[model samples]
Target: MSTKIAACAGAATLAAALAAPAFAGPAYTNDTGGSFRWYGQFNPSFQSFDDGQEDFNRLTDNAASNSRIGFWLEQAYGENTLRFNFETAFGFRSSDGVNQLSTGDNVSWDRTNIRHVDFQFDTARYGRFSAGQGSMATDGITGADFSGTGLGASNAVADSAGGYAFRTSAGALSGVDIGDAFSDLDGGRLGRVRYDTPELAGFTLSTSYGTDVLKDANDRESYDIAVRWANEDAAGFALDSGIGASWTEETGKADQRDISGSFAVLHKATGLSLNLAAGERDIAGTYAYAKLGYKADLIAAGSTAFSVDYYDGSDMVTAGDSAESWGVAAVQKIDALNVETYLAYRDYSYADTSAATYQDANVILAGARWKF
Candidate 1:
């Protein structure tokens, strides 16, 4: 290689060597308790339809707001430190295959994009606080643990489990985007405050409250409160689980309520993991989730994983005939990229016989996401 090329290679290696420790995971590690990390990720996926019924044939297919990219920065300082997380996803999209374009085109995005943006600070003895437009604290974002980068069967559990409902209740103003936390699921103009207690052995607790400023004419929305307690790292077996609830105050009548809970267990020596999540949506609906997963590191990349999940909900909880569903998938990581994917089949049951709808629907998506 030329002298210039060798020089450039040397500089790149030196830079990576110097930057590695600053961005490693877990801000407070060991006695050092200080560092910074910066990382970005990109994921894009596509779909092909085989909708044999309803003349669902079309021209082109695109993944809509499914593509994403962004990065995060975190640092620790003594008993107190600072952290910043910024991320965004493809805002909105339209599909082009067999009339699917109409479905994708209507999904408009106003202020919501995928790059989740937020910053956090630790008050040490006081509390840890987070601010900015970031992930919704609703039951789903806080409780749902579906492995994929997309929403899945976890919603059924989050909505029905009573203590972990995925934040899909009242603040729902249909006039906005799809994923906004307060408006739709896309994005919302809101702020959140979270406080966590220091852990005692394998136990800790947390509570969070949030709402959108533009929600009410005064730009003030209802306050959603969440509480979680977990027990873990006991004996040599590790386990973590907790429950939470959210309530919205109405002007006159009783308040709307959502509650949810989840638990995970790991047999460290055997590499076995199991999880269960449940949610309840007021008097309107219910949700439950059951899953089993295994981790084995015999391969070159060290570890591989597999899992299965099932969920059931009330009639109004999910649309159609059965309101019951299940999904399964696996993941393998090699070097800079890990390939993971999942597909779920939903059976929607109907309460009214006079309705016309697709009795059974299926969704399948699989792809790879890379980070650097």
Candidate 2:
């Protein structure tokens, strides 16, 4: 098996092997044991655009939120429990019908990945703490709002001139997904510890602290902190929001700060949901995305959903310039097949470069996926 598949499978086996015995001490009691879960997805999309080549395919085991797939291990030991996850996957693109894999596939181990060898421990009075490679915990919103369209990796805040072209995919590792989501901040893997308070009635609170997993020569640490609240879903509607920041001090870089916040309210009744998010990066500038969508009862003998998204990131600071972009898509589910089509456009400009000042780009996507 390939390294990717092997790692993914090994992680899964470990999670299974950790299961408690059918009958045992306090740790294996019926009240102290929970089950394990495996989740996955495959999203392969095609495209046609105005800038880059048209007609391409991209697949990720985890889509919907960011095309992520992994197994979650949750065990109960009285009032406290523990959880862990692991996943192995890569980013792929296609043109015509050819699968064009990138060379970075060798190490995308950290790109668009959901499981980063992480673990969470919980105790009734002590709250919960999680550590390992993980996302900075805060308002739970950053970059393109998890559009699952790869908004920040290959595609970030597009300038007003070029626009943050939706034609470019951002996935999790935006740069490499575009230029290279594998290096530096492509889902920059670091150390994170999170503490979650016990839920009271219908509300709970959480806080986290994190550090850069990969440090520069100077050995400075990137600090992350934030808090969030959540309530049990009510009448098919749920809400999530939070705020936090990232700061680092080192030799080659000035200690910079990033303050980000976002809120989302979801309703499942009547097949509809709206997502709105906006955030600012001290170094990335600023980026925000909004989406409104609905699942139709039926269309052409199949179930379907339509949605539109708008993005703005001209405020992002770059050595070159900035960009802007937009995207729209419709997904249809037929029998066991799910198909989706999308179109995107971007406009970009240069602030310092003397060469071509701008580029107008566009892309169209089509994809059909099935699962076991």
Candidate 3:
């Protein structure tokens, strides 16, 4: 097996081995026809990085969501429904397959970030409201995606090499952070209360208020509002679009605000897709991203997609510093194996030549994803 497939399969096998004994019984069910089901995903990838001075390889978790297992519970209430979901997972280093629960090997192996633990009430007519830890209104609305290229090449550059360091022409480690400087501010999920309005003529509105995860001190809080329009496969075309704004305030600290939007369109007949996203932040200046792709049944029993994406961020690092990122990628889906295999190449460069520590970098990523 290729490195990608091996890692993907190994992660799945390990997860299954660990989860099987823990989930031996039937899922909880009630008399009201409510049911619960378990679901999970395992994605492992291999990335090669060239910092313009030296090259290295990294075996890591998925650049996207990592590996996870969760449960969904549903309860019927007349025409409405009450739902609860719980999910938790952790990342493992591919190089050694070592599971590091927490730093300092602390007194308690209190590892793992609780990704989601929420309860939702959905009304057929009114809308949906959710409480507990979950995504806010603008969580994923701003970084729109309609192409398969998100696995390796997207506006969120951290997914691929979240820990990699940049090397300068002098062969010295650059102090500038690579992940934040080159990547866009993908929205974050927080412990929040959210309300989403029912779809009205392909439009929906949502709002949320959240306290920071861990309930940090200094009275930290966030609020978000978003509007989205979606019409899938209507008149041989599909559209998904959203716009959102957010504010974060902390007593005695600089308040941060952001405005972000994205649109994605697809031609059903030709399998052609286009996506664009733009955002401005109080600290990170402004950034824009665009992608073009085409999907076709080029392989028997599979669909293949080719795409190119570009991103430009002005003053992304500091005043008068800008970053440019571009990539080309291809993905092939094998339905028989229930796997998606991808290969992608991306380049990163900064425009501030005055800084001796800033330099160009190149990255290549290959990965496979299995979702169940």
TM-score of 3: 0.86
lDDT of each: 0.43, 0.44, 0.72
User: How do the residues 326-367 of candidate 2 rate in per-residue lDDT, one tens digit apiece?
Assistant: 555555454423323222222222232323333334434344
Off by over 4 Å in 1: 1-37, 48-78, 92-110, 114-117, 135-189, 213-220, 230-232, 249-255, 317-322, 336-358
**What would the TM-scores of all predictions be?**
0.64, 0.63, 0.86
Instruction: Please provide, for model 1 over 270-323, each residue's C-alpha lDDT reduced to its tens digit, 9 standing for 90 to 100.
Output: 767667776665745555667766667657753566667766554243333134
Backbone clashes counted, model 3 = 1
**How many Å off is the CA of 4 in candidate 3?**
13
Pairwise TM-score winner, candidates 1 and 2? 1
Ranking by TM-score: 3, 1, 2
**Candidate 1 structure, TM-score to reference:** 0.64
Best by TM-score: 3
Predicted candidate 3, C-alpha RMSD:
4.8
Whose TM-score is higher: candidate 1's or candidate 3's? Answer: 3
